[model samples]
Target chain A: MFFHIILERNLQLHPRYFGPHLRDKLVSKLIHDVEGTCSGRHGFVVAVTAVENIGKGLIRDGTGYVTFPVKYQCVVFRPFKGEILESVVTMVNKMGFFAEAGPVQIFVSNHLIPDDMAFQAGDVPCYETSDGSVRIQKDSEVRLKIVGTRVDATEIFCIGTIKDDFLGLTGDPGGAA
Target chain B: MASTGGEEEDASELKLGEDFLKAKCLMNAEVALILEKKFETLQQLSEDASSQFSQVFEKSLQYVKRFSRYQNPEAVKQVREVLSRNQLAEFEVCVIGNLCPETVEEAKALVPSIAKKDRMDDEQIEQMLADLATIKKYE
Candidate 1:
């Protein structure tokens, strides 16, 4: 007569039984452990298990535990910090003007225009040149003031003005075209 | 023969122990591999997130630069109203003269009414104007 006992432990006996969900859980746990152990370490590791069962009486005789090989791969990444840049305007309107500098876009508001400068109602920052030419344009350069920044959601709002002497038009007034 | 059977049993037990060790090693390896894959995926996500953050920062900076031009308190509505039309004209002269008394005297001379209302005597006005000229020369 033969008696069989199913002695189960935390250990897995076969690799085929390891599913994606379990693998994911194991990976997350490992990462947490690694991160906790090391301060400011930039990456994490993943583990894969493969189990094989070799026979009949092995289960009944307290010999169920077997060893298997595991594969490892490292994943690394460093957090990013944004870049600051200057932009030039390509167009203007009553609401604002469009500007481009590097890979970013910029806007200058009507309120930001100098008080001495004339702004026609409904003209969207339109003005007349000294030689009788009417030009509706935004200044090429503007100084930007950051009001708020959101990193997780990736959003930024900035207030722009041209009132500063250093931030607006440059050179002799006659040379402006 | 009984001894031989005992020896076989002993061998079987040893084999089972080795199997158990092998299984444990395999499990550890699997866990490591899974964790590595997860790390890779998370890493990619973080990179993408960081890139987006950078773009937002740049855009925000541009807006700040543009809005900074209008930050002057002197340009607000109530302040402008208080200056009045005449005050604005006088302010313009003051600005042109670089806030010198000579410029104020010139303005008074040009606008006789201001000179009379301000009660500025001719002698006082002359002295203020001369001092302003001297200041202007040094500037």
Candidate 2:
């Protein structure tokens, strides 16, 4: 899920950058520092929309650095347990297939897949249903339900399942619309 | 009688949970729009677009473009307006907008909270779905 939320971060600026371009420097620095970073608490910061505030700078006596508290609005993508997400399959294996929904990586174990879809080992590994009606392989689009999640400092790992109703291969792999 | 509705289910079972329970949601179309604007700004600032974008931003831009059901900004705004006018929560609004479920049954299955809350009856859901489809068709 994508959320537009306000987040606060303290940015440290060197004394050299304390001139007329200070605000621009801080905003750009905030973008560079925050975008694409993942926090266990806030998920992945996709983009910084706006800088809401820059608090009073606190100077450090030793380093000659100024720390400013910055509040910004950003778009973050966070997957929650039970959320349904459309993901593109990145790889397939006997253990399960690894799929990516934007920045989040999800592992849908073989057990989480429907029982009828048998794993096919080949140059291009894939899971196919009997009668070959459905195939889930690399680049396949699937709608799966997130069953569990583990968040690390720089990444979010999720376990998803397509065993339930309205969950499964959404489109053929590598198909052009 | 036993509770068959979502009341018996754990809050985390199909819920957004505490952190996101009240956070404003963005539809894939809106994200695509925002990212495109950011990209335009970045392109004006630097010759190398690759250097300015983080991997997450790049991936998200691609994903949103590919999955966004409504590409036209007008359509996107209208979709949100239609959903919000029906009193749908921000999260629910985006979920429905992103998924573009063809039927109410599918919508309810993908977002169980709508069903549990009884926010809309079957007829209203059908109407909302029709409204969304019309927007997509025109867009």
Candidate 3:
């Protein structure tokens, strides 16, 4: 999910950056420090859309540098439970398959797949039906539901399933679209 | 054995999201084949439904087909989540998820309680509609 959020930060500015371009310096520093970072409270800060307001700068005791309070609006993307995502299957094995959607990697355990399909072992492992009508392997696309997730600063690992309706394979390999 | 056009899920794919979901169901061989041909993506159910429920299944089989508006159950589920998170009422979320009201006035019509509608801000309602637009493709 995406949210428009406001966040505050105290920016410590070098004395050299205290000139006419101070605001520009502060914004660049803010973007560099804030963008692409994640916090457990707010999720991922996708981008710094704008700096809403900059409060009065206060000088620190030991250093001649100034601390400026910056309030900014940004776009954030956070994954939540029960969020269904359409991700591409990356690897298939007896256990199940791994798929990546955007920055998130989700695992669909074999146990969660529909009971009709069977796993086949090969140089490139895949899951198929007894009749070989449907198969899931690397590069295949699937619609999966997020059952659980573990989000870290850099990436997300999710436990997902394709056992529900309107999920699974889209088109069989030999079939015409 | 797949080329997941992702959103263009066949019948079997849609069926995964539901369970004997009461609708225009089918027990006849020809209807099964029609469903297979039309929604080839859906997994055909096993022939052995509990004997006790077979009669009830047969009675409701005729209406098992998916409606054009609600063709993608995944989209419907997503819309429901969006509504619930935005503080929309429970029954209202179900109604909106089904009807998928695209505007505030339209949503107010489906959820007749003006007091409930007054609780949600314009942005929350708009975001709900925007989310619904993404899932309108199952038809």
Which predicted model would earn the best DockQ?
Answer: 2
**C-alpha lDDT score of every prediction, in listed order:** 0.33, 0.87, 0.57
**Model 3 residue B46 lDDT?**
35
CAPRI grade of model 2: acceptable
Q: Is model 1 an incorrect, acceptable, medium or high docking prediction?
A: incorrect
| The candidate that achieves the highest TM-score relative to the unseen native structure | 2
Clash pairs for candidate 2? none
Q: Which predicted model would earn the best lDDT?
A: 2
- How do all the candidates rank in terms of lDDT, highest first? 2, 3, 1
lDDT of 2 by residue, B1-139 (tens): 1211222222223455566667889999999999999899889888987787899999999999888888799999999999998887887788899989999899889877777656679889899999999988888
Per-residue accuracy of model 1 over B1-139 as CA lDDT, tens digit each: 1121112212111221221212211111122233334446556878763332223223333333332222233322222233232332322222223212234554443333335555556665565456445433443
Per-residue lDDT for A1-177 in model 1, tens only?
A: 000111212323444434656455444433333321211112111111222222221222364543322233322211111111234566665575655532233455666666555545454445334443434355444323221122222212233455443344431222221
Q: Once model 3 is optimally superposed onto the true structure by TM-score, how far is the C-alpha of residue A142 displaced, in angstroms? A: 1.6
Give the per-residue Cα lDDT of candidate 2 at A43: 85
Positional deviation of residue B51's Cα in model 2 after best superposition, in angstroms: 1.5
lDDT over C-alpha atoms for residue B63 of model 3: 21
User: Of 2 and 3, which scores higher on lDDT?
Assistant: 2
